[model samples]
Target: MANDRRMTTDRFFGGVGERLENLQALFKFVDTTEPDKAELQDWLESNTAAKSESTIKAYVGFQRSVGLLELEKDQYQTTPRGATFADTGDPELIFEALLENVDGFETILQTLDNEQTTTTAIQASLREAYPEYQLPQAVVGRHLEWLQAIDAIEKQQSADRYELTSFGKRLLQEKLDQKPTIDDLEIGSTYDRVELHEAYGGARYRGIAPSADYPYVFLFTGDSGTEHGYKDEFRGDTFIYTGEGRTGDMEMTGGNKAIRDHKEDSCELHLFENNDEAWSVTYLGQFECVDWFEEQLPDTDGDHRKAIRFKLEPVANEVEFTDPDLGAVDTDELYERATGAARTDDEATQQTTVETTRTIYSRSEAVREYALRVADGVCQGCGDEAPFLGNDGEPYFEVHHLYRRSDGGPDHPDNVIALCPNCHRRVHHGKDGDAFNQELISRAENVESDSGK
Candidate 1:
């Protein structure tokens, strides 16, 4: 929550360059101005880059909103944060105040978390989140400019896209108790850099994140990497992925070793295409490293080094569906296996196709099947029988995760519940999703607990 002062004040600002230099001019005006409320606008426009009185007023409001400027007896004054920045010449203090005091500052950062976005995308997101503000196009652009001005986000030189900076990531993690809000990751799916790190760790700045905690070694490659000649592309049936190492020789160590020996370690290889246009990556399906060879490549430091590039072939892991074979396993055995079982990804079983493979994990399968079986042709949420029969001639139910898969929630019996379509929508899209989810949570706990007995 913003302070009462910030909550009531207007945050929209206009006119002037959305750069740090413009802001510094304002601080100078404040230092030189006399304590006169009536002459403040004149002083601002004349002393600063703002040419219009309205822009000057807007700047004042913006500064006040961020705790940079204060109104003392109707005269313009600087706050402690403002005074400190003015004295020390540090822009971090200004950005800190913006993140801490502004209503939509942090929201904008989170919106950019997964990938870089256009000014238009940022505007659309702001409208969706804070429609009441109804900020104009220019106001929104100014806000983004402020973010870039403070180094929280960087504008791509070639395009209008804005990418989050390392400093911005650090601020989000350290200042705000923020993490990825992604609920689940469907195979053949796409995720942003931020969500990738949240799901498996080890993927933000590197080409290959070891992802030892998960069942796969995640490979990230994008058009950006092509700049350094660390290009990852496809050749016939093989997806060629270059080894990781910025400087010196690219050795078969760390993430490179992880990728080379994934098969020996019982780890799968998951390939994602990092989008050049946006900040997200698309899963191209799972791959198997059939071969690897050393190649001479120029490192970031401009040294010719030996790099290990891997030959990846599409993995066609087979998964057996249980719908046809339902009830073949005894209830006791089903409960035993399904209890606390987990999976590599969110999908309950692998998709049957040899291309663009999706996971239908056996463990997640157990979680889904156990929930559906225990429901006994009933809707878990409403205590009513399923709405209709599926193509398999059984009650139809969609499994809902009490905790999200992207948040590292397990695909175990305790974390999922089966619900009818109507009940499922109510849990996810209804007016009170959390409240409705709470109802299902209780029912799921009861269902899992009763089966244990």
Candidate 2:
């Protein structure tokens, strides 16, 4: 409701000092319809609640100086700049305009931009740089507060200092580029293309491509010997897998996206682990995605990335294959070998970057049968007999690892136990699974460690 036809650029700003509240009050005052001097004074008193009319007059004079207001005859009206400031309420643009027209404001901003100095420190620095302009500490503080109010700088409460925001940085740099647009990938569109290995591609591609749950089929060859990777393993009906979300310094954005897309029973995932040969991988099978959790995995690069580990159960009717090389080694013999290599101290557990090749050998069935035979048709846990007979007319029981093989626990008789299906599931998915596992570890007489059998 203000007229600016007679305004000139030279008459734009006059009384704008470090006190930015004056400009804020002026903007609020001009947002109303045309008001006379008395009405304007009343509005200023009611809104800003300034004790003195001189302070209010100074704010009004600053607005008139900057062509934001034009007080003619007796009525006060908003000029073009005032109307624009009232309409947008954008602090950054207002501050930028002030820098262009307001004297000494830009000098203060340039002196303190991107510097993490407090108000007192800024005054000291400014006095050192410009002794002629002996600005008081209060003036510097008001300048800092005004910059903060106009979104020109960020205040770090914890540090008791100041830092330049992105917008503030741009303002100091003398240009503000238009906001850039990002063309995000469509929900169902393929984001990345992965080449399935020649050996496992056939079995891994059992489901349709680009399913709602599985946007893509991922192939993970555990951590590069020296780098970090998901610890993935295959057991009877489950593929104990970790989510692929991180690597050394590079985050696998594609892998993270896959994790986000995964849904229980809906996301069909494939499992693969490293074999002995360099760059060789084995396709375990299709798996139904399950729960996931955050884990801190050691990164070979000395820095760490937040990793996500996932649990998966083998999908029904999927082909199962074991490493032919590890065929049924005798359990007692395997036990001796495992205990011999069992870690003796914390040194073996500390994560380090080792530039060496690693191998993934399937769990030995011979070890399972030996544990069962040792149990002699009785559940090692609960001291109860087998729940039922299998199709082969043998007692049915599940073999469990007292110490998880994933955590570098050896696959030996000393580390394995024979349990009924109920007890087996309970130890893995039960609320007190960890305590129960410890109990089983303590009760087993035949289980051996590095010290003895």
Evaluated with TM-score, which candidate comes out highest?
1
lDDT of 2 by residue, 328-391 (tens): 5444544443344443367345523444333333234445655776788899888899999989
What stretches of model 2 exceed 4 Å from their correct place? 1-32, 128-130, 175-453
Model 1: per-residue Cα lDDT over 1-453, one tens digit each: 112213222323332234456566566667677345557777556655557767667757777777888888877787878777767767688777865555466667877887988888887776544433565777677667667666788889899898889977876666445433223545446677675665544445567765422455678777678567595754323567998877777777767888888889777777777665465877676778878998888877677878788988666422333434545656655665666334445344453333352333344455567778767887878889988899989888988777643234445567777889898878767899889887777766775588675
Work out how many backbone clashes candidate 2 has: 5
Ten contiguous residues minimizing lDDT sum, candidate 2: 1-10
> TM-score per candidate, in order?
0.37, 0.32
Error of 2 at 385 (Å): 99
TM-score for candidate 2, please give it.
Answer: 0.32
lDDT of each: 0.66, 0.54
